[model samples]
Target: MGVQGLASFLDKHQNIYREVRFGRSRLLVDGCNLNYLLYFSSGLDQNHGGEYAAYVTLVESFIAALRSCDITPYVVLDGGSDVTDKKLETAAKRREDRIRKAHEAAASGRTMCILPRMAELVFIQTLARLQVPVAQCFAEADQEIAALASEWRCPVLSNDSDFFVFDLPGGFLPISHFHWREVRQSGSRSSVSCRRYYTSSFCSFFGLRRQLLPAFAALAGNDYVKLRGIDWTRFVQAGTGTEACGRLEGLLCWLKGLQESRGPLEVLEEALGLLGDLSGDKRELLQNLRLGMEEYQLGRSALSRFFLHGAPPEFPALEQEAGLVPGWMLLPVTQARLSGNVLDVLRLLRMNLGFGIETQELPSANQTSRPLRQVMYGLLLGKDRSSPVVEFDRAGLGPISVPVEPTFTRTSQRLRLDSLPQVALSDRLNVLLEALGVTQESLRLLPPQLQLPAAVSCYWLQTAQPPPDLQRALLLGMSNTPRSTAAFQNKSGIQKVDVDVSHAFSQWQACLKDAAQLNQLLGLPLPEPDVSRLYQGTLVHQLVHRMRSGGKLKTVLRSDRPSEELYRSLLSVVRRIRTRRTRQTRQKAATRRQQNPPEPSADLQRLFLQDEETESEARAAVAMQEELRLQEELLQVRTRYRTKERSNRSKNPDLARKEECRGRDLL
Candidate 1:
């Protein structure tokens, strides 16, 4: 329970201790060996002696001390055990196979190892399982741990002297006091001294880190046998000796077996997750490690498959030909790559127009004698049906003939204003102009009609017209007719034509009759008016027509005496025309109905006959007595005759008469 040292360390490094508490310590541990020890110690029952129990207690105490000091600890355990001896043997064989693979990799001049080394795997697995809040490495655990300690400026925790080769930034601290005592007793005073001795001894004995460790090991010797002072030099030189080959084979087999072991898989996944979560330098290292592992496991052939085909050479070359600097050239290339052919053509036009052209090195110096002609040909051609040519003055260039080619003779011309073709250019020209900072007045100064050839002009002509207050009024009546019926309207009241003159003139017919009438009334001897007068007259007529038809005639006629008279005349004419139109419409409707009359039902016809008789009697009685008496007598005689006729007709009198006639003819 001695905890003074632990408490002191925590107090001294409060920030470091806080980080550890929050799981931020980048501590490395030996997983496989720790697990083995834990299991071994746990198995110690009273029967197998109390020694294991004591060991476990001591280990637990040490862990508690570490926790109290805020030193997060990770533990590693070996896979081999007494009960799994056969498995261990098989695993060892696999390890040797991996070592041989590593040797082969080294021979092939690759920096990769064949398998995650035993110690490295232990450290990685322990750190991963414990979820130690720090960067960790596995496979050649001691080496990686030392490397990590150097990277983090932290201490390395291990009894292995091999870690000294890494030159850890915070130095080394052995886990066991007994080991420290043993080293001290062996005349190594300080940890640095001990480390130096270990480094020199190992390098001398095993020739470690000589170009490539695995290859050298494969060629010269084995550590286990060499450390034991066994002479295997001749066997190594021959490259066919059993001992040297056996050791190398064993080492490779052991690595392969470790790779197959299930313990490393979870740790590898955790490492991969950490790698994914990392950024900057840490992430890069982890990535390199991951790649190395992949290379080790899958071999170089698999690694080769990950590379893509090299980019085409002509792309950069084309950019260079465009007289663009490296970075600037790429933008156009990118634009060209993504845009449709039409856009590309536009871009080329802009480039030619000296829009984005800056003086730079052309692809060839010999070609500099000729002026660079950059003109947007697309601007001369319509992008689509709706495109229009934008007119602007060309700037910064004198007439020069551009060489067509080595075969065709150069055509010398003033880059004639007439040379440009007329075509539909998009409004995008304005944007380009703005970018160029060119003013409209400057554009106007260009040669007369410096008309863009192949460019269709879409010009709009605006006319200045007086306001609505100056508009004249015509009169319209409820009968839908204009009162004055003037063949022409007066232009004197018209202030202006707000819209384009061309548009107003196009609708000139609507006001033409009004114009003729106005001319007749005014007695203004006029020939066929010009477009301006026509537009002006048209505007006046429209205003008058609108006022007359706008349903405010009383108010419109109230202002002026002359207007009232005119209004009345127009209204009278409008009403007469409307009345005639209405009558004609009604007559047509009535005639249509009579020609295609609907038949009356039987009941209606009977009612009509009864009513007709009653009416006829009433009318007879209302006449004078004598006239009435005469009418009544005549009616009575008519009725009697009508009855007799009906009877005769019904009894076949006609047939009888025909028979009598025939008999007379026979006689």
Candidate 2:
């Protein structure tokens, strides 16, 4: 977690950072931070679920830039939330903020830097494909990243404000200043020119001791320690637009007065004492402040041997704790094959922060994927499914955490978590199919990669509230297929996102993502998805428009026989599933109606007996419900045909005049 306003404060002082031609060095990349920076900065479509194909291209280009400069990069990612709950409040607060921002974005149609759920998967998979060295830490990767960077004596490239506080020997290269695209060449060698930050320079410029950086971070209110009631801005001699930045300056100025001879503990005590009227207990505040400072204290990198010798990092501390993570899963967890959400579900009986945007009057996109996650929880918790997993999700304009029961079908109920890996591949595959409610025979016709997407589409059609129709589903399927990567390249400008359509696809992607993870947990019973091939939102939405106007599917496939075949197979599977489900649903309803004949309610009977008008009103109400259902379906299409017509009329004065005369004649 970064210190609030620290990055901005350092950015103001140009002397704190030195211009350098960065090359021919080992770079320890903060994978999580870099993922956010790369996606948000690239101007990719965020509102329309995601533009994964474009995102994949961007990631490849970034890696290519580093390779061209001969920079050996080691990427580190955060695994799960800290089990200790030190940053629990901070994480929750940020989640709440994101939820609010997401609502605002949904309402205003403005981008809120919401990284699409599939973006992380795409990033990690792309790196794996490119043969980059990557590691996922057990907890927040900040300390681990700092530790590894310190040990390797390499610069950490990230835009996280937390990096400014760490005293990295090789220094910090902020992504904001990292002009990686502008590679400078001098005869035989090339380098990425950028600004580098050294903590020593920051401390010296502020006239404070290098040893006191941690103390400064603690006083300035990091995520771990936000000392309330103290008005730090009051001490500011000068102010900036951001109050937090001014407080940071004030804190540094105060630290400058402290004696260099004083130890860290002494300096911390002095800073805590500055909280004249402490909001909480003084002792507790002191403890938190100490913990905050301790976050920056690095040890010998735990990942060095893992990076050098390819041995997975051991978590003996976690292993000793009974029923934390199974010993078998430690390797996959480190390799980033399994989602860290599994750890959270197991450790705390709660899954934190399933991020997505919510639409008004529409069920949460997550609601559609709840059953899929429930099965995932079953695979994770196994025998321990008595207690439900509390899932944090966006509800309306606020964040809500609700307990979700783990679902164990007949097939998955027998699989034990500890021995899951030892189970036969067929049995594992059975569990995946059972969870998705599809048979192996159903998926056999499609490509292995398309199998999961097709299965997920079937589930989406069956379960999604206000379900997507055949044409939309076909468009989504085409967009997700690998062939579509080349068929529908990234377009130039942002297209207006259809919220209803976007939400439906978001639900589908969420289901696909969770199912893929469960499949990974079950040793990849289905082929691993190339996420880059799946769901380019911009292309998918464009295809939807084309399909709306009666465009031929062959044009999108570009007459590529293999692509056309894949599309047809995917469509056939979906159509068969939808048809079977509809028949089954109707049969079930017929059976239920036959078993329990509906009786008119006493009120309805009395109303019918009392007046004919009341009977007509009841009939009208029934008709209204049908009308509303039709309207909901119509709204999902969100066709812009009328808007386009109006635009054309506005552009051509003759067309507008002709339309006006035609309207008068019709009247």
In candidate 1, which residue ranges exceed 4 Å CA deviation?
1-27, 37-56, 64-147, 153-155, 158-201, 204-231, 234-667
Instruction: Tell me the TM-score of each prediction against the true structure.
Output: 0.20, 0.85
lDDT per model, in order? 0.29, 0.77
Strongest candidate by lDDT: 2
lDDT per residue as tens, model 1, 351-470: 111011101111111121111111122222322311222211112222121322111112112111122212112223332222222223322212111111001010101011211222
Q: At residue 456, what lDDT does model 1 achieve?
A: 9
Q: Give me the displacement of residue 276 in model 1, in angstroms.
A: 47
Q: How do the residues 148-174 of candidate 2 rate in per-residue lDDT, one tens digit apiece?
A: 899888999998888998989999999
* Residue 554 Cα positional deviation in candidate 1, in Å, after optimal superposition: 99
